[model samples]
Target: MTDSESPSGRFRIAISAWEARMSLWIETPTVLDKTTGETLLSFKDGNWSLDAARWLSDSIVELTLRKYPGNHLPVNIIATLDCANRTARIGEKEVQFLAEVESALDNALTWRTVTPPPRAARSGFASAVRRFFFGK
Candidate 1:
């Protein structure tokens, strides 16, 4: 996954909240890996901050398994940002979504552009199936 900068003139870090159908909120205090006693994230006030940015990245990734709780997880969720035009995306969906969000943000703020690595497109159904089973 690509690491991103904080939105224009804003803190180099930002916080966002993601939730599933049950409405359970994801935070640092939440269990990351129950079997391993790992916590998904650790926010001081159910929030994200610049100081916790790196930690949040790890935390959010850890959260995916629990939040999905199964192999075939239909990733349906919402991302709420503290700042307008900030970028966020869920799972592998982040590539295109980030581009869209970041483009809008850059236009709004007139920030200089930075191109992210191109997303890989599966060449065929067999490759797609392999990736699905092995998480390439």
Candidate 2:
């Protein structure tokens, strides 16, 4: 793991197993909305990857839109995963906040609350029967 310090010295970023996967883990105190300077998210010494951050941001936006219907167009989350600085910014070109936008974000954070079905179940009955008979 190669560790790097941000210019602000607020957070540290590490790149682990880079040869196998180009994943960056960022240890930051909070993620903020660039325009509003509001704390959108906070972590308890949590290390999150850029991909995860992007997905989470997108999910929060989508959930916010569906849960509370309104005009929330062109609002996207941008992540800067540079070794020097690991940060996220909310880009709202056309912004309209939902009544329960915060609630939606909280709900989106519980993305893994529901467990997925097993591989066998996903392959269907025919695959299960074939595996049982063939001892695969």
* Clashes (N, CA, C under 3 Å) per candidate: 3, 0
lDDT of 2 by residue, 45-136 (tens): 23322232322222231111111111233222233222212222223322233323333333333232346676554377877888899965
- After TM-score superposition, the amount by which residue 106's alpha carbon in candidate 1 deviates from its true location, in angstroms, is 31
lDDT of 1 by residue, 35-86 (tens): 3443222343332112123234322321221222222223223332322222
Q: Which candidate number would show the highest lDDT if scored against the true structure? A: 1
lDDT of each: 0.34, 0.32
Shift in Å, residue 10, candidate 2: 22
lDDT for model 2: 0.32
- Model 1 RMSD in Å is 18.6
